[model samples]
Target: MAVPFSHRLDWSIATNRLAQALTLHRPQFDLTASNPTNAGIDYPAGLLNAFQDPRSLHYNPDPRGIESARAALNLGPHTLLAASTSEAYSWLFKLLCNPGDAILVPRPSYPLFEFLARLESVEVIQYSLRYAEGWWLDYDSLERQLTPNTRAILFVNPNNPTGNYLKIAELHRLAALCAGNNIALISDEVFADYPLTGDQTRATTLGDNGECLSFVLGGLSKTAGLPQMKAAWLTASGPGAGEAAKRLELIADTYLSVATPVQYALPTLLKHGAKIREQIQDRTRANLGTLQNSHLRPLRVEGGWYAIIPTPRTRGEEEWAIHLLENERTLTQPGYFYDFESDGWLVLSLLTPEADFAAGIAAIHRAFTA
Candidate 1:
């Protein structure tokens, strides 16, 4: 019999092997920063205090999740959380999709969606956010990728690595397209709290009078810098139009996967999210300052913790990264690792410790200059 593995599993298959090589080399200034706790920054003691709330002893499992957690989400400065993600996902699946449905996802973004789709048994068709005229969304490419199988579109606002947010106008266009085609909108806004500059507010998930169902995914990972806390949520919004709420409820019930303590502690944890977010934003701002002052030139990332630095004309990024590891003893991620369109790119974590970030940028400069 043939193997049961899916094609998505084959994507990025070599990352693990390359990552293993780095550990053996003991490179300094590891710039592949994703974990908040490992970045050498301290999360506040208030986080622990929030968790000690005695209310956790009671098992209050709401398929819609704790009302307070949803309330905290809705209270965002420029966005509102659709009441229950549990109901949202369930209804989202029902209202617009079925098994083997094709979901549109952004390219040059985080690769996690492929796995997420695979777990859901959904086929993902990636649309390029190809860098042209300064990293705008390739709407033309997106239109070309759509087919009868397409049931939803997924976006990472303030997209990872690329660091761009869905503009307000673009959000309207996306909603219009989805609404017209009876497609759902699934947005991963986990990085929304980290808008790089400007108004720092982008379009919200409220669709045109609920014509299109929208799901916003976020968590304490980037928002509160407490990934270990394992608190993530999907907020469902949009006019249910019909049956949207029912489907969402079923989805949440199937996977009452969240821990009881975490669910109970969510309200307090969310309350503390602001403090954690402030520290992270400050760190990102300072580190970005250091990078800007240095020799390397980074593509404008509107949000997210990483910067994609365009490499020098002569060298490919993997070669540069490998040389940096073996010689400069600095560790950084190659753009190819994140499926960049070309070879002349590198990704650096903005959340690295100040000294390490500074030194890593310096090493990157040295390597690029050489």
Candidate 2:
């Protein structure tokens, strides 16, 4: 008999299989591409030379990361480093929850939370982000979802696919709620730097949040458009933050997974990374405008590198995606991929080169209108 594997490792979705098979058969104009390196932005030549620092050749390990790199974030002594935001999530899960304890995640946000939580034997409860003119947290539903076993609440600032930031008022309310309920807040702010609209009311970062215990996650992945470098930070704040930091330090010590060269290269990468960040912001903005001006209707996006286009309800999201792929050679992510509350939504990455984005938009338009 074969050894049994963890139930968490036992799943694969049919849509991914279909997409892979289709791509293997023919070329696809893939609008679902989110990787910055594949997005055709002009990264500065020799930008990675910072990793060559002679200091990195010497082995020095710090549980909270090397001083220079942590200092580069300017987030004070509360910050800890991880190889990636995914790893940061794993560490936070371990730090915050015991087996079968729960965390609250936002619906219509990135689908990563469930997988990350499951791996740690933590249950994921979802709160709603309702959409009408814009996306806002359904606080009533959020409160209703809370249980005594809930240890933390995770939300993406300017959420993936949905592209809506947590408003300042919402943050205040969330802080109050978490404080009252004794739940920790985990804010994923990787895309906070890429606002697509001039929204002054959005909460930009949770690094200084003091109403309750909080963890603010960010990294070069979205901030500097350098995902390959593998550097991410977690900032702890709010009441009992010092204690939280100490515990997180112990968790980080076990891994010390961050590469030495990347830690040393962080300052240089962040300083010179401004140009790359600008390029990404510009690319996303231009593509968003193109999408807005097209015949298709897209939800209002406040920030992030993705936009949601609502397709015809006559067909399901996956069917529409498969239709476009088969007929127009265009690829899109079905709403189910992000666990959207309803049907008729398809997600597109705004990081595609301008011309290709436009072409894919036209193709989508053609597929639907025909």
* lDDT, residue 172, model 2: 91
TM-score of 2: 0.97
N/CA/C clash count, model 1: 8
Best model number under TM-score? 2
Models, CA RMSD each: 3.6, 1.4
Q: How well is each residue in 1-370 modelled by candidate 2, as lDDT tens digits?
A: 9988898665575557446758555636888879999888788888879988999889889999999999889987799999999999999999899999999999988888888899999999999999989999999999999999999999899899899999999999999999999999999999989999988788987657669999999999999999999999999998888999999899998878999999999999998789999998999999999999998889999999999999998888888888888788888889888899888999999998888889999999998888
Residues 1-370 of candidate 1: C-alpha lDDT, one tens digit per residue: 9869866465555555347768678888888888888876666676676667677788777666666666666633122222233223434555466678888988887866666666566787989887754567889889999999999888887788888887777788888898888787888777888877874346643333245777677776777787777767765567553355455556666666666666667777777777778878888888888988887877777778988788777767777788788888898888876777778888999988888989988888887777
Per-model C-alpha lDDT, please? Answer: 0.73, 0.90
lDDT of 1 at 43: 66
| Clash pairs, model 1 backbone | 86-248, 87-248, 87-249, 90-247, 90-248, 91-247, 91-248, 210-239
Cα misplacement distance, residue 307 of candidate 2 (Å): 0.5
